[model samples]
Target: MIRMQRLIPTGDPARPVEFTEDAQPVPAPDEALIRVEAFAPNRGETFLLERPEPGLMPGKDVAGLVVQAAADGSGPRVGTRVVGHPPRGGWAEYAAVPTHSLAELPDSLSAVDAAALPLAGITALRLLRTAGSVTGRRMLVTGASGGVGHYVTELAAAAGAEVTVVTATPSRAERLRALGAATAVHAVAGARGPFDVVLESTGGADLPVALSKLAAGGTLIWFGQASRTPATLDFFDLLSGPEGAVIRHFHYAGPNAGPNAGPNAGPTYGRDLATLVRLVHNGRLHPEIGRTADWSKTAETLVDLRERRIRGKAVLTTGVVS
Candidate 1:
């Protein structure tokens, strides 16, 4: 049996998880069996546990060593180190993941860092790509201290954009500045911009404020609703005459077309993952891992993430070979 951290919903909203052991997974023809070493906890997973299923694994990002290659001769070979976004979920000692979702890891990256990369990294990368050329452009990234926000800030900066960040945590300003943000502010009202592009993640009153800052012909990409609050906007102000800016919403699972494909489709996942890993290896990008604990602390880790006690990314490690 594999000792996996299954999400056992307690039916109590306050405390909702219990870990249990389970049988080891076997890979299918198009799947790879990975001995998972580390995984990251995301706030999105909290909503998934609300219904309380019995034996559901609650992680999407995983990093580990491949113990069994796919039966159909796809993906990485056995004994390769990899990071993946498993479809059925991945908080376990072993996961049977689709070959298409896997990316080989470089020797320089740690399991914790790789585990933190898949969802947040890819989201940030793809959203910025959608904005076209960012070199010398003015960009505003809302929620710039959060998981995806930070990556967007760093990557945009690396692309030569003059990045301005809006974050609730002012204490993270200096760190964000070091990552290439020209300025970091606590509120959107404090930001200075006629920004060429706005990556808006905080959806609430902030959404309208973000919309107001976009320069003529600028594009605003809305990818998340962290506040779980609604925003009211006047149609006239949003699309005013010929100077009205553009607003595009982004989700990882959208349909594939041209270079803009869904996260799992075509060569998007593997290609993007490879580029991200290379950037990290070359010191061009950094994955901020805020907290890491043994997998035994999975429940507490989730609580910390939900309460906003942890900054950046929170990771859980198995700490032993399977």
Candidate 2:
């Protein structure tokens, strides 16, 4: 039995995480055993922890070294540094991940930086792709200072879109501009647009405002509910114009939504991850890692994340990289 430390849910909202010892996972024919160097928590995982069966592991993005290669020789080789999204969880010392969900990390990226990719990065990429070609299009990204929002701004700008960012934190405006956004504002209201594309994550009242900003025949991709509140909108009025906007709700792991996607889907996660890694390597994109802490501080980190205190992404290290 390979002894390893893993974070499990405690089923209590106030204190959601607890560490426990578990046997190291064994890799399958198409899976690789990773020695996790670092990992990041996602808001979606918080919702999962509220379930009755909260004892399961609770992380999705991880960066680590391959301890064991796939039995079928289909994934990364042993000793390769890789980042992956494990379906069950990843906040552990060792995890068994499907090869197709693993992306080899670039030499320049630290484990902490790579850990911040995967789910957030892939979600951002898919959001852009779902919005169709952004070349010369006028685009707006709500929650622009966030993990997915930052990436969407950068990627869209790189694709020749005139990117504007909407952020609750006023101080993040300059940083958002540095990330390739043509403009950054605290509120979506009063922003100049009839935007060609709107990638919205702030769900509550902002949803209707975002819908209103869309240009006729434009597209709006709603990908998150950061506000955790219900949004009210008059559908008839919102969709009344002759060139009504196209509204799409995107879930990265939704059925048949990605490459080779299935009930246990994630192959496309690896491909998108690889693309993001290349962009970072080539200096075309920079993933923001907001903070880093020891794995022992997992509870505090999660609280900060849940409380919306941290900016960009928060990463937890297993004391492997200094």
Candidate 3:
């Protein structure tokens, strides 16, 4: 067995993760073996790591070079540069990635940038697909400073939607606007809306306000609860909003969630990632990576992410590939 260095949980809150040597993974017939160059940390994954399960390993989004192609010849050939979404264990020197959840990267895109595109980018893509055409719609995005929010705002704006973003500070407000927001305000209360579509991720008190902003028959996609507080919705909260308004709970891994995760069919993670990469290559979509650091700082990085110190995606370089 070939031993490789990887990050593992320490079961200590103050030092939640530490590095260790583990046997290199063998790829499944439908999975490719990757020499991981970089990975991105997400708040949701970090929260789980804070009190990790006995065998849990943290990692979701990664980018690197394929050391071995899928045994069944399902994905890119060996030596291909790729970005991938593995179920877990991505914070390692090597990871076995399912072919369907991997996509090749262009030479122009760096491993760090490609690493930023998986979980958040795909979530944004599927949600936008579910909302249908934003070409002339009014869209409101809460929690607009985070990775998913940035993608939602930029993609909607690029599609000709009028985007009103809610952030907490002037700096973030400015960044949101530069990402294509038509308007940026300090609070949801500052947004005057009869929005055709609303992407509500920050839960707690703000969720009801986001609901109230939707136009009649408009859609509100609820994907996250970054506030870590449950939303309380009363009969009045529902009745006060426009009639026929819809609230759709979004899960990137839902049964019907495929490449599009919309009303359309045929969802594959590879195809969805490919679309995002193509958009990046064509200068149509830009992945906003706000923080980058060496892989040794995984524990501290998670702390910063939880404390709201990092603004967008947080990428870690593994130094496994140049």
Candidate 4:
């Protein structure tokens, strides 16, 4: 029996995520077995690690080579390099990834870069698609320093939207501008808006303020509450805002639709990932990788990510130089 090194929850507050040896995983009929070379950390998964359930494996984004093809004859063939989202257990040497969640990687793309594109990339892609054509429109994005936030800013800007991002971090603001944000303000109030679209993630007190900045018929897509605070809005205040204004709930994996669905229901996880990868290959999209280290540093890396110390996406190589 072959064993692989994987990360698991220790269940101790002092150190939640730790490394362990586990038996190699077997692929499901519709899942391919990937020998992971690198993986990226998302903020949500790191939070779960702080008090994870026993036997819970935590990982969503990974890039590597296919070691075994799926029994059902789906996805990339063995020996193909790919990037994927395994529901869980991706922080291991091998993962059983569903075919629908995987995409082939080009030779020009490194495992580290590809690993950074799954969850965050897909979320940003879908959000922008939901907002429709941003060409010449005013848009505002909160939490611009985060993985998903930066992607939204860049993609919207590329499509010709005038993007204004809110971030208290002065240093990160400059980086956001280079990614195509027309302006970066220290607070939501600093923004000059009535924006046609708003991709808000920082929530809390900023949620309602963001809503207030929307144009008459604008859409406000609420995706996350990184502030970890509740947003309280008065009924009258909401009613007083722009007419036909909407606040749609969004998630990377979900129904991706509401009362008024867009022409596209939304792109699939695998489909969006492929688009992101192609954009990256063509230099049309850049994955803002803020940190890269060996997989052994996952615990420390995750801690930095949880505390919001790390910017953009964090990638960890599995001791594979090539």
Candidate 5:
């Protein structure tokens, strides 16, 4: 049994998580036994807890060392420096993760930075990769100050895309500009668009309007919904327009998601997260991590995130946020 932390979801993040002294995990043939040094969870984990799903261990990202190798040599050998986003077991001290999702942690990255790479980094990478003609293409990233959207602004700008960002906080405007966004508009900014690709990281009332800003044939990838509020969109409204466009609902929970998490096996876990790690290693993708929490205090911050106070990624750490 492995010592682990589990959220006993009761609609409150401030409450201390249940400490499980012993949790057992079964490793499949293509899995690795990782000695989890530190890990973090995305916003999805919170929502997931509200709507319980059996066998779904909430936390997804991890930075750790390997402890065991399988008979088929399907996983990284023991003692490999690795980081990954597993389908589950991220908040635990030990996790049995698919080898496909693991990537070698670069010599340059600390465990804290490695912990930030998987979910947000790869989402930005894929969004940039599929976003066509980014060179001089007008781009708008909703929730531009958040984890994934912030990186989208950075990578898109580096790709020579003229970036326009939409953020909830006015103070985040300067930060967005620093990340290479050509301009930053507060939530009240009038309908602005003609964006080649809109990274839909925030969902709610402004969602449809943001989608409307996409130029004809423009694409929008919906990766996250920070607003507890739901969206109401008419397909025809988006589908029929002078600038008739396309929309791709993107959730980074897939196989080719990060710079390292590789060809996964389960229905939802395989993605090349390694490519994301490589970018951070090469300096193409930089995530604006606004806050971090230790396993000791993540519950408190998660509540803060749920309350809409998070300006950038709120990373949960085994180490303090200082």
Candidate 6:
């Protein structure tokens, strides 16, 4: 039987995440089994473990070699190095990844970088797209130094948007500017803007300010609620004027975005993965990975993430688990 590492959580991550051995999976007619070289946890994974699905493994971005192929042509060939987004099983030593979710990695990029691409990259791309054309527009990004937020800043800046970054901490302010912000403002200052677009990843008192900055026809897309504070908006803000705003919430794992999405959003997963991986491989874009931890230290990594001590991505290398 194939061996793997899995997480089983009964309470919050303050408790130890149990590591267990399990039988590795065999591919059905269309699924491929991935030998996970590296996997990274995202916020969603933490939410998953604390909820009803206590047995869920907390990683979606996976990079590794394809050790087994499907009977059909749907799966990758044996020994092909690739970065993939597996639904729930990626934190394990081996995962049965659906063929449609796997994207081939270019030889030019390292597996570590490849492992970092899919989740944050796809979310960023999707975030900007939903905000519509950003060219020459004024945009603001909250948590501009974060995993998805940094990429959002870079992507929007690269698109020629005049980006204003709102950050809560001073440490990330410089890096936010370096990521291509026309202005970097602390969350407390509430920078001036009739923003064409505003995206909030950090919430709390800053939410209304980010929302108010949006210009008419401008859109605000917020996903994460890391600030652990309540946010309320007044319709009077988005009601009128050329500088009025639009607000929308974004979450890839929601009704229209994730595994349970409808026919209209059918199979959009690998599409973004393909585009993001290609950009990384071509040296056009790169994601920031804060640190790499082994599977044994996965809980510690989660703690660091929760504490916001690390920026960008934190990944775990399984290192030949069998």
lDDT of 4 by residue, 230-283 (tens): 898888999999899998988766655322244554333677778889999999
Model 4: runs farther than 4 Å from truth? 257-268
Which 10-residue span in candidate 5 carries the lowest summed lDDT? Answer: 264-273
Tell me the lDDT of model 1 at 290.
85
Candidate with best lDDT? 3
How far is each candidate from the true structure, as Cα RMSD in Å?
2.4, 2.2, 1.7, 2.5, 3.7, 2.9
Tens digits of per-residue lDDT, candidate 3, 219-270, equal 9999999999999988876987799999999887775556544465543589
Candidate 1, 80-119: lDDT as tens digits: 9998988765887788888878899888988888989988
What's the lDDT for candidate 3?
0.90
Candidate 6 per-residue C-alpha lDDT over 147-264 given as tens digits, one digit per residue, 9 for 90 to 100: 8877888888888999888776766777767777788887624778788887887678778777767676778788877777888766675464345345788876544554435655
Q: TM-scores across all candidates? A: 0.92, 0.94, 0.96, 0.95, 0.85, 0.89
Of 2 and 5, which scores higher on TM-score? 2
Number of backbone collisions per candidate: 0, 0, 3, 0, 17, 4
Clashing pairs in 4: none
Identify the superior model by TM-score, candidate 3 or candidate 5.
3
lDDT of 2 by residue, 269-308 (tens): 6788788888888888788878899989888778777777
Please give the lDDT score for candidate 5: 0.70
The stretch of ten residues in a row with the least summed lDDT in candidate 4 is 258-267
Q: Please give the CA lDDT of all the candidate structures.
A: 0.82, 0.84, 0.90, 0.87, 0.70, 0.75
By TM-score, who's the top model here?
3
Lowest lDDT 10-mer window, candidate 2? 259-268
Question: Could you tell me the lDDT of residue 243 within candidate 5?
Answer: 72
